[model samples]
Target: MSKLEAGIVDGASAGYGAVACTEATKNPVAVANALLEQGPHVMLVGRFADEANKNFGFEVVTNDHFTTPYRKAYWDQTAAALGQRDSGSEMGTVGAIVLDEHGNLAAGASTGGPTGKVDGRIGDTAVLGAGLSADSKLAVLCSGAGDQIFKHLVAANVAKYHVTGSSIRDAARKALQSISATGASCAMAVIDAEGNAAIESTAKLFSVSWAPASGPSTTGLLPTSFPILPTHTIHQCLRNRITVDRALWGGALCSCHGRRRCLSILPLHGLSKEWHPVTSKEKEFHEEYPGYISSNDGPMMAAEKLDGISSRIRAVSGLTAPFNNRFNGPDEDSKLFARIIRGELGQWRIWEDDHHVAFLTPFANTPGFTVLVPRKHLPSDIFAIKGEEFSALMESAHSVGNLLRQALGTSRCGMIFEGFEIDHAHVKLIPIHRHSEATGTTVTVAPFNHHYQGSVTSLNGPLLKGTASLTLDAAELRKKIPVKTITSPRSWADPPRHLSAVLQEPWYKSLFTIQDALFHDSIAFFQKQLGYKYRAAVIQAVAGTTAHLKSLLELHRSSGGKFPRVTVDDALKLVVMNSNDWRYVVESDTSKGRTLTRDGELKLIQHFGGAVWVTEMDHLSVPFYQAFIDDTQAKARCGDLLLGNGEVLGAGERHVEVKDMLAALEQHQVPAQGYPWYTEIREHKPLLTTGWGMGIERFVAWVFQHNDIRNMTIIPRMKGISFAP
Candidate 1:
């Protein structure tokens, strides 16, 4: 497994810095893709930093594109706009994207903390396994403080917890609680491909701001309980278009978390459903792509501009990141200056007003999908542009939107302007299926929860599967039907029979008989073994059955009036109050058929070795339960020998200590390969783990030649998947 690699970005003043890790490879681009693709698999801690470039705004580019000075300048400029002074030399953000080329997991991270931060201070972003950790199976991220992260070992601990099967949210909660114990504020997000995730924060003041891979946005201190996605009533505006920015999704913009700044934009429902898994075709061609920036949105500031005057560079280049805001003014001469360099002064029928420019990429083949960029480098926003610029921006957006509808075969289109918020104005025109088309002909109804039995009858007719043959279980059919309940044992013993019974009664199916019979026997066996064991035993009469009569009489003694003061009812009520101890009694006196079903066999083995009355027997073991009764005839012949003497027995058989014959058998040995071979290897493979075992009831029922296990009990069972008979 590859280890984690990390880096730090010191803040403007030095206090706020971001830490990052690129896993398993040195390729920063691969690292970037992996981070976006599989994160927040890596733990993030202490104000994790993420940045997008204005140059690569609408286009999809590899991480290699980020290495250019222009891109770096863009990053620096955006940071400066966020209240940091730019050295105009290099970028401070730290990151790398790499694939698993060497078969080892690797990661790296770096960051410059909060802007205008105090000098010499560091956040959790730079530390390995603090903000990020990478192994073959786990990756994590922390988005809070290094101090809090360290206090709880949030990254590593959350990563480890995730490996153990805790859900991501659960692990996040634990991580947060761990930090909270030390009175530290923490927020984190973890994604483990292992189906575990945890998003949490220690700041009671903390709020969860998350954009789900699917479903709606969430913000606030999430409840530890409930599915990761919460259900709520939604409106149209919040369902059409949205920003890709995670912070914007749930952070300051969420009214749910009491963040009053939640912007009410159209929900990106179409994008959430369709634009996912951006295919090569989708990326290469824009077809009503609702998420990407569109024409009329302004151009991005590629990089931070320097004051140095390079005549040659200035000849071919436009203003850079630090260009004066006046670049967007109605200055025609200034607009013409840019137009002259591009060699398209009115020749290509260009429209310029020192504010915006429109251009179609050489590769752009789709109709109505053009890029709009402002002459000045600034964050793009639908609400920010003014005067002619605003009107021009809208006109451009409308033109493109109409073109998209005509070309993409859609009625209306979605407009999304998400990127370059820190610096540069941009917008996207995305066409989508009309609301009616998307909704389909039928409305979707939620599943019925109350009084729902997972049967077709519980649902509306339209939702039901079949039409010709109404299921007898359907609500309408059942309402007109009469249900017969057997209150007395006699009624159950001799159920009323009729010819129409096959169609009207539920018991017409032979499958029901087999199921009910087996279940009934199993339930009895469970109660006999696990319930008041001293109270009863299932009576069976057999000619060769040793102690058969004696065992019956012994059980009858307990059933008689001279029973112990504290009865089985008391024992059952004390342990399992819901238990019906009376049901454990098996009165098979005149019975011709007695047998145990598969469920009986299973229940016998499970309950016999695990009862309050039997649990204390250390020697008792389940493995032996099958072996002892596996050969009941042999066991019966050497009863006392199997019973005990000086030889101690396993837990379940502890009450029966061996003395003579059994003690002698303890040391006997015979050929290992012989058919009837026998041996007493207690000392070598000591009977330290022995027990009173075997589904004796099942064994008897099986050997007794009964067709069903229910014959062995009083009232047979009628529910559950598997039954005794």
Candidate 2:
């Protein structure tokens, strides 16, 4: 074994980034055993830093409890790290090679074999030169089937390619292509003596481009003198013309080969004979793309423009960490307009003026979703982009809107300002397939809220309970609504199911399981989750719950239902909840944000009608009830973990009232010392959960913030002042 890890910490910023380790007891074996336990034999054990909070904790590497029947616990690994497929390709190694500042070269790997193989199973992990190798000249690390890798000495082959003067990226790519031609899946990450690095994976390809102040601009996937590129930052204009050397898609068009969709490349900066990763004015931004997932919409790409730039919403749909007003900090890096005007992240640049530029946005309900922004001025958002600059942008938007009918084969395109993700003042061109789909911010309700059941009415009208939650038992609930699994198109930006209903079209497919889960396994699951005495015996049965939760949440968020994401702590709890708890309602608003506090949970409750709860446990542990409580709609309840000794732990205040647990709780006050997870409504009674809800239209309306989307609800209005216009 390559030295057991002293500790695994994701020190990405500190330069001691995530270290991927593979495992190997010995050689390869094709003695395929029965499906005894072929679960994803992947374990992610590490201390990940919470960057926003500046805290660190050992993230529970959701122990992949099982490999068969596709358990839910398997999802946290995908959410946190590069998600691995669980089926036939379960035999992959985790390895890396390094070339340091002083020219030190070192390589290491750990391997996991196919389901049930012999101990002497030699493959890449056991043999250094197969999965990885490093010498004075170069270092190479790889991940893939060990059998194919060992036989070809894939690592040594890449080194030989490097010795023969092939660029490190090309050398790795060449070796990978050669072996992959034989149909054994493989990918490579490489580094040469000068400390330059490159990576190739079956999942997707990402280009990390940087322009150092003194030396030539560098991109791992690109050559200094333009090379035949497969995937580059897409910057092509909307004119549909395809060429092998340089073609663009997803800014405007897309093509699929087999199951893989090669979503790559932007029109080489300005179509010059030589391709530059960045333009002259982009010297200010330091860029980093730490890999991305390939998807139907496009490669779910991620780009980090650092040194003080406004962070952007990563390509992960519904993930809006980058959508902030962290712009214009009087620093060169903060100048996003300077980079945008210089063609810095542009794709499908159809038209431009002295003051504005129009480009394609990835988040689209229709194919040709585009955006119009000011080029000459740097305004924070729509309110700031005023006077001549705003007028110029509006005029450009009008011109672009006029062309949408012909370009997208739609009757018309509507423009709306959505500042949820991008703080920059830009207008989105929604290609309205239906004339009346666009309805602006209007709140509609289901007319049944316990809070609003009998409330004081304003001069405008009575407070309408647009949505409500009835605490019904499983029997009672099943009688009312049809319960089935719905599979949405794999894009988070696709119109949500509710919105599709608003349009009277079912674009998504609903998957229905003819039966429910096996109750014995389910019983053991809740036992393990609640930490009963027999919990230890149900390890295998309960271990895979996380993957199920991860998948469910991903599907929900991707399908346009509000699924608030969290670290493995609450997420794993949710995995258990999916199996054990009969039905769970993710306490989220129509928009986004979940808080689990009596203190901070007031926002969602006040906005509509809800309640908050906290079941404080040890900060180091995940309590069963805390799972239900932490499922709230606030970013952070911001509490503290404390001991009876009265030492303040993480984030809270302990009153004399908290000493009397039942008394305080009966009055429905609270309890706490930790902040791992929390939620609102009914007390955390064992085996029972009461919840709240609102109209789906109101929630999705919040998600797709647009005014033109009018809904002709079978029933339009009721109590209170419902949106009419």
Candidate 3:
């Protein structure tokens, strides 16, 4: 026999029994018999019990096999109704009491333990005297609530009564009475040395039978008072079906399957007849506004119109309440924009007009952080506005930047126009402090200083007379500006790092490298000529291009040995680099050779040293609101302020003509239906104007010399993914 079986039997024998059983095993009766033959020991549990059973040659079954249909049904009903399994019930056990002619008496109990009992539970059935007891005078077996039976030592007490000279019947009855006093119920049968037997129970007992040596066996009354496991609840049955379906498919069951099955089973008590994830009106609202509310319309108001939209409304509202709800309505007192317009938000207001307002952000990461918001309700995407309103919006943003610089005691500021959290179009202005504060954390900033060049020269005019001098001798340029080599080895596929490849990386890294290299050269050249830092040195020039300048530069290396021979007119039309895709390269002559690359022997050159302003951008590269420079439609009246690391600000004059707006819209492929109001405003009350915005984080990072923009925001939201607070 296994050590565990031997131990159980030995322990039972030591406690006045010759046999024992455990419901934890597949064949409890067989295990009991094996233990009885194996000899004494106490308990075995968990993995140790399993090992013992294996060694004793007892069949082992999976835990699931022990869950009878009745037990599972009962568990389902109880858990569905009560949200927890019943723990007080006593069931799923059996035992036997025997008397041999040799005057030997034995009692044993076997059980699968309590139904729904947690793993590793050792019940009274395994606790020798608690469930079974035997002596020369009598043998007793008891079954019921394991905890109460174990506490009362029911079997042993009955045996003790018999050994002390009480009749078996009287002893069993008294033991039961003792258990009843404790508010516990149990059933028991007792056998004396004379072969007489008595059965007694405070609770209903299972079937009872007896047979005489010289007579046929007869079955006695079976208890009918015990409650049968209740039928499984509808919710329980539905859950069971879903579980089975998921197991069969090895994936999520279709939501429709659940709904259909549920509907067939019972009525959906709280759901409406017309249920939809998103109703027709909600879809229309989304199509029109995309990311902003229209007028006084909102999700709550929309939900009231739909039969089953409340639940979805609650779900979405719960997730976005902290951010989106703050800008729900123009007159909402809780809205930051509304409070700011009312002069109730922020430390101070910076600027305001009939159509816009600006103020310092209370949760500023930097000393002079400000937010510029439109006075009128507007969508988060500025492109949703049309004609002069777009231009006016840009102008307002530009004014905010200027105001922030003056207010914060700095000549430079960074602005960012992004609708990250709210639905309204807001621009953030971050002042570019000249020097880092002593108490502030370390940050990265652009090393190159800006010397503002005079007014932007018209690119449509002839090239400057000294334009040829701008292309310095490669060998001479190298002597003035030392170029860093790509020391890392490269394969055929991975060529030496070029300006084009460098431009593909994050703007901060690549742009800084280019700016630093050019700045060093410019500083050296000007210092040699002036014998000091030429703070006022500024060079401005205009070059036109017939083809897209950006595309021309990208294809320079592949365009054979010759630079694309451009006519004077081609050079005049500047190809605006929209987004972060544009690359600027200069052909330079070094000690090794002449090459067109960012880090090649010939260094890159900027028309203006400090902040270069370039206008007349390619029409296709800019937004629809940007007005065409002329009827030719080749260039738009848009420009960028190349300051700090790179272009820190962008401004564009908006198109006032409805026809031009339509054409621009077609070029950009924006759905026209969604912009009906914007189109109406453009056609009716158009105003010719311009606007610009700057990135606050980028500007602050540039001023503080911080490489990462993420460090600039207190609760940074990255690519729409938020982290736990």
Model 3 Cα lDDT, one tens digit per residue, 128-199: 677777767677777777777887788877777666666777677656654553435577878877888887
Kindly report which residue stretches of model 2 are placed more than 4 angstroms away from their true locations once superposed. 1-88, 115-120, 205-725
Best first by lDDT, ranked: 3, 2, 1
Kindly list the per-residue Cα lDDT of model 1 for residues 338-400, writing each as its tens digit: 443244342211223355544332233233333455665443445666777777777766655
lDDT of 2 by residue, 607-657 (tens): 222211223422223212222223331222223321111111233322122
TM-score of each: 0.22, 0.25, 0.29
Better of 1 and 3 by lDDT: 3
Better of 1 and 3 by TM-score: 3
lDDT of each: 0.36, 0.37, 0.48
lDDT of 1 at 456: 15
Q: Tally clashes: model 3.
A: 30
Best lDDT goes to which candidate?
A: 3
Question: Which number leads on TM-score?
Answer: 3
